[model samples]
Target: TSIRFCLDGDEPGRKAAAELMRKYYELGYEVEDCPPPAGYKDYNEWLVAAKLNLNRMNKRADEPVRA
Candidate 1:
């Protein structure tokens, strides 16, 4: 099973994530870091952008491609 990480842009958040990453690394678990989108303030903004991206991808996948 894979774990999803939502990272924040703040200093404290970054530090926390870094420490967690180290621990995960030591445990040999596959971890992915989701960085905040450009122009975003925090995780909430990044989440919104990520959701939008996922929605767009789903819509595109459902559409028929033209030859």
Candidate 2:
């Protein structure tokens, strides 16, 4: 199984993610990096936005459409 590292887009976060990827690659493990969306600074923010979007979609789906 591959290992995924979800890191923030900040400088420190990017450096840490790079170091981890290098270390794990040297250890012969398949690793993937998942960064947050362009507008988001981190995963948590993106996650919240995604959840909110989902909730809005569900709410709209439950509403009756006008003729």
Candidate 3:
């Protein structure tokens, strides 16, 4: 399974991410906040990143079955 990272366009989202990261730490999950490449700002910046990740995942022959 994959964890989707999402936050609203405001300060609250940042705060939520911080708190959620702490929880993930307790649960032993490594978290990486998405850094917008180049001139982008957030996940929806290019729209292609998400699609590419999903597509690559789908095409992988040995991908773990997401529960």
Top model by TM-score, which number?
2
Q: Show model 3 residue runs off by greater than 4 Å.
A: 1-4, 35-67
The global C-alpha lDDT for each of the candidates, from Candidate 1 onward, is: 0.77, 0.91, 0.64
State the lDDT of candidate 1 residue by residue for 10-30, as single tens digits: 777778778887788778887
Which pairs in model 3 have colliding backbones? none
Question: For candidate 2, what is the total of clashing residue pairs?
Answer: 0
How many clashing pairs does model 3 include? 0
Write model 2 residue lDDT over 10-35, tens digit each, in one string. Answer: 98998999999999988999999988
Estimated TM-score per prediction?
A: 0.56, 0.77, 0.43
lDDT order, best first, reads 2, 1, 3
lDDT of 2 at 50: 97
Candidates sorted on TM-score, descending: 2, 1, 3
Error of 3 at 64 (Å): 49
Candidate 3 lDDT at 15 equals 75
Better candidate number, 2 or 3, judged by lDDT: 2
Highest-lDDT candidate: 2
